[model samples]
Target: MDDLDLRLIKLTQDGIELVPEPFKKIARELNISEEEVINRINTLIEHGIVRRFGASIGHRALGILFNAMCVWNVPDHRVEEVGAIMAGFDEVSHCYERLRSPDWEYNLYAMVHARTREECERIAHEISLATGISDYTILFSEKEFKKTGVRI
Candidate 1:
């Protein structure tokens, strides 16, 4: 990565401008062509310097008040199949498979967001019904301590 690439990263680390041509805007700022800006970003991604380049929505700002961490005690053999189903739900923003111990047998987790706790529960129920995995718990988030992407 060159200086221009560094500048491009710094410019877009927070977010790209909400313009009709965000890349063109960045190109102007970087004194490079729009294609170069896009190519640099693509190279960064291909090289795994940027694992993801996507939107980050603010659920609270959108009136999605309840965020629940739903944990499921999925059978060891079906963890992948069950996790895919859980991740497919629209309400679930994040799904993960975690190592469990004797103290905590829940191996699968998903973060579900909704306007209310009841909605969260309903979504959880829908997930349970879809996956046929009812041995689970939903822990609502009481507070948000941090919500930001990694800084370069």
Candidate 2:
């Protein structure tokens, strides 16, 4: 990848257009062929530079009424096991493991979505039972501050 490839990745991060010839717009801006733009994106993913290509939807638009961030105190040896279980749930939109601080204990984090706060809590309770990690925290969003792409 070169400077142009980096720029392409940054530009595409804003989310691709929902049109037929999306790459054509990008190619025009980059002064390259549409085929080249598509090829480079594929190469980026092949080399693991690009994790995956997809839209970042507004959950509200899709009738997702509630969202919560769940943090769990999973044992070190069972992090992957518990994380995978959480990730398997359809209610979970995002799940990962993060470094813990001295005061902070929960390491496994997941984003749970539902049509209501009660539903979100129900899913959280089920996850607690499945993972056997009752010590967890759930933080819900009051409002969305920003939603956009990162230029990396």
Candidate 3:
């Protein structure tokens, strides 16, 4: 990546506009054409320099102040299948499998976002109905101690 690419990454690593022509605004700032910005970003993605290009919505800003981490005790044989089902839900933003233990019977974790605790429970019910895996727990968000984005 060149200096301009680095500058672009620094400027937009956090976020970009939600408008239709966000790249045009970025190009204006960089003193380059919108096409150049798009081309550079595409090249970066091709090389895996830019791992992802997307929008991040702030739950607080959207009045979605509540969230939950729904942990599921998925069967070993059904881990992948169940995880895929969980990930397919629109409410779920992050989902993955993890090691389980005697004390911790849960093997799958899916983070669900909602505006209220009740909404979180509702989404969890939908997930359960979708996956047929009722063995789970939903831990509601109390406070956000730390949150960060990717950096180079």
Best by lDDT: 1
Ranking by lDDT: 1, 3, 2
* Tens digit per residue, CA lDDT, model 2, 1-152: 89999889877887778898888889999999999998999999999888877766788988997889988999999998999999999999899999999999889999999989989899999999998999998899898887564567
Give the lDDT of residue 72 in candidate 1: 96
Question: Which candidate, 1 or 3, would have the higher TM-score against the true structure?
Answer: 1
Best by TM-score: 2
- For model 2, the superposed segments whose C-alpha errors exceed 4 Å read 16-20
TM-score of each predicted structure versus truth: 0.79, 0.87, 0.74
lDDT of 3 by residue, 1-152 (tens): 99999999987887787799888888999999999999999999999998768775677899988789999999899998999988999989899999998899999999998888899999999999988999999998788987776785
Global lDDT of each model?
0.92, 0.89, 0.90
Better of 1 and 3 by lDDT: 1
Query: Model 3: which ten-residue window has the lowest total lDDT?
Result: 50-59
Query: Residue 15 of model 1: what lDDT?
Result: 96
| Backbone clashes, candidate 1 | 0
